[model samples]
Target: MVQAQDASEEAGTEASGGDEAAEDAQAMMTDESAIDDQAAREFFTSGSNLYSLGRYHDAALQFQQAYDLSERPALLYNIYLAHRDASEHAEAAVALRLYLEATPDADNHAALTVRLENLERGLAEQEASRVSAATAAEEAVRQEQAERERREAEERALAEDDKNIIPWIIAASGGAVMAVGVVTGIIALGLASSLDENCEPAVDGVRFCPSDPSLELENKQSALSTFAVMTDIFLIGGGVIAAVGLTWGLVRLGGAEDDEDAPTVSAMCGPTGCGASMRMGF
Candidate 1:
């Protein structure tokens, strides 16, 4: 009988221990719930303050935190409100759906449903406009690039044509001047022949013969000297100009062996006559 009584006392002690454990668990849960409620209240207060300050994005974040802390449908509605006010229709729609799911029987279900539909429609339109704008901008850039390339090609072509024509023009001008010189030299030679014939026997004889004294012969000799000097000037100048043009043309045509060297022209006009020389380098 005493052993039976001791067994009953052990059972009684076990029961008392179980009750204390249950009490401790309940207290822990209450503390956790209180902490969560305090966190939710703080988040909600911050969210409201942000909303009042017109900081919708920050307000949305704060509201999202409050929902995370307490999982309250009302907090989600506040998040939706913040997102809508911020013009973030996509996020607002998502928040609205969550609110509807959490509280299907909420009194404002009809109003929220209408709001969500409007947000969805706005989201669709915004997405369409963004896509259209992107396409137009890309096309504009492509056209601008094409126009720029065409302009550049045309300018290059014109420049290349100028480069090709300049040398030809110089060469033609030089040839014309040289022709003039040749013609003038022939006339001067004829005049010299007449002067010599008048002086004496005109076979390679240019010395003044005292045997024939005439003022007309002296004047003809003076004219011959002037013509000879003029002829030399034209010939030398023309030859230098022609050489410059030909050298430039050959260099441009990539036909010159030593294109690195540049040709130079020099002129001399002494008491005797005018003459020109070309220092052909390379």
Candidate 2:
């Protein structure tokens, strides 16, 4: 009977120990949960104080820390509200997106959807602004290219006209005039030649020729012949001078004509007009 009483006592002690251990574990778990809840409450209280002080960015940070600790959708939504109040639209959008992901079927689904739509609209506005800027830049480049092409075409056309048409006309006209003057001078030279042949001849066989009376007459005739030869020489020289003068005049006139006919481009680039005129060889 004493052994049976001792065995019952041992079993009762084991049962009491087991129940105390279970209660201790339960109390530990409760204490840990209370510590976590206190930490979360502290964070939420700090965040609410910052929000009341109008320090939305600081409030958002505090709320984000509370959400990290508690994993509460309400805490995340408070973070989003603080971010929005701070005018940090991007941060607000991110925070809201996180909240929506956490609680898709929460009570405020319509409000979250409206916030996402506004964020999307802001993103769309940013995209449109970028596109407009790019299009304006492209249009400016195209306009500059077109203007350059137009100026180049105008310069090329002016150069071609100067090279091909006007120079040819001036050269041909000058050449024709020079040829006519040369032919007329040659005819005059032939007439002078015939006159010289008829007027001056010396007879070597006759002692006294009555037709050509004296040496004085012969001297006069020789002087006249020399004068005629000098006149012919002067005429030939004058004709050559005239022909050269004509060619020079033609070249100068052609230059003037080119200046007049070509389109004048104004330039502010220093002296010599910045090569606006064509350099055609005369």
Candidate 3:
């Protein structure tokens, strides 16, 4: 009987030891759960602070972390709210769908489902608008490029036309010189008429002046001779220059018509003299 009582005491000690071990394990699990809850609370507070500061995307990330730690359907709703405020419709829809799936018996399930459909439709419209804007921008760039090319082509053609401008300038200069000659001739004729009216008839082409001959009559005769010489010089020189310019222009025009790659000729006239230049390309 004494040995039996000793065995019972030994069994009682083992059972008490097992109870202590089980209690310790329960305490450890409780501590771990408290740590997790504290971490989740910190994340939830950070998310709330970010949302209040209008940092919606950052808030969404914080709330997602909270939801991961807590596995709470309510935290998913907070994530959806953050994503929605940030205009992340797709992400908001995903979060809301996850919340609905996690909590099938939610009171607002029907309303939330309708809202998801609307969000999806709006997302589709947004995508379509973005594509249309991109296409319009591409078309605009294409039109601008084509317009630039056309303007460049016209400028090139104008540059080619400018190559023939020297001939016209020479011709105009010659015409102006000829006009001056005609006016000088007219003045010479007027002076001669005045001289004839004042001078008397003479023998051997020597005019006989009055005994008291006026100095004005002699000056008039001198002026008439000078003007006549000037008229002849101007008319002849101007005619030659004009003819040269016109002939050069005709030759260039003919050459251009015959061959696009023909030799080119250019003429110029100035106060000193007139000149011709030629260029040949092979």
Clashing residue pairs found in predicted model 1: none
Flag the better candidate by TM-score, 1 or 2: 1
- Put down candidate 1 lDDT per residue, 108-210, tens digits, no spaces: 8888799788878888998999999999999999999999999999999898879666767777788888888898899889888887676665444354744
| C-alpha RMSD values across all candidates | 11.1, 17.5, 12.0
Clashing residue pair totals per candidate (backbone < 3 A): 0, 0, 0
Candidates, ranked, TM-score:
1, 3, 2
Which pairs clash inside model 3?
none
Give the runs in model 3 whose Cα sits over 4 Å from its true position. Answer: 1-36, 45-59, 71-74, 97-114, 141-166, 186-221, 244-282
Cα lDDT tens digits, model 3, 87-189, are 9999999998898898889889999989988998998999999999999999999999999999999998797677566566677777887788899899988
Predicted candidate 2 versus true structure: per-residue lDDT over 1-282, tens digit per residue: 000011111112223645988766766776776676667777788888899999999988988887776677777778888989998888888888887888889887888789788886897798899999999999999999999999999999898666555544544554554555455556545544544454544343112223555565455444444444444444444434444444444555555444444322221223211212222234
> Cα miss at 40, model 2 (Å)?
11
Q: What is the clash count of model 1? A: 0
Who wins the TM-score comparison? 1
> Between prediction 2 and prediction 3, which has the larger lDDT?
3
The better candidate by TM-score, 1 or 3, is 1
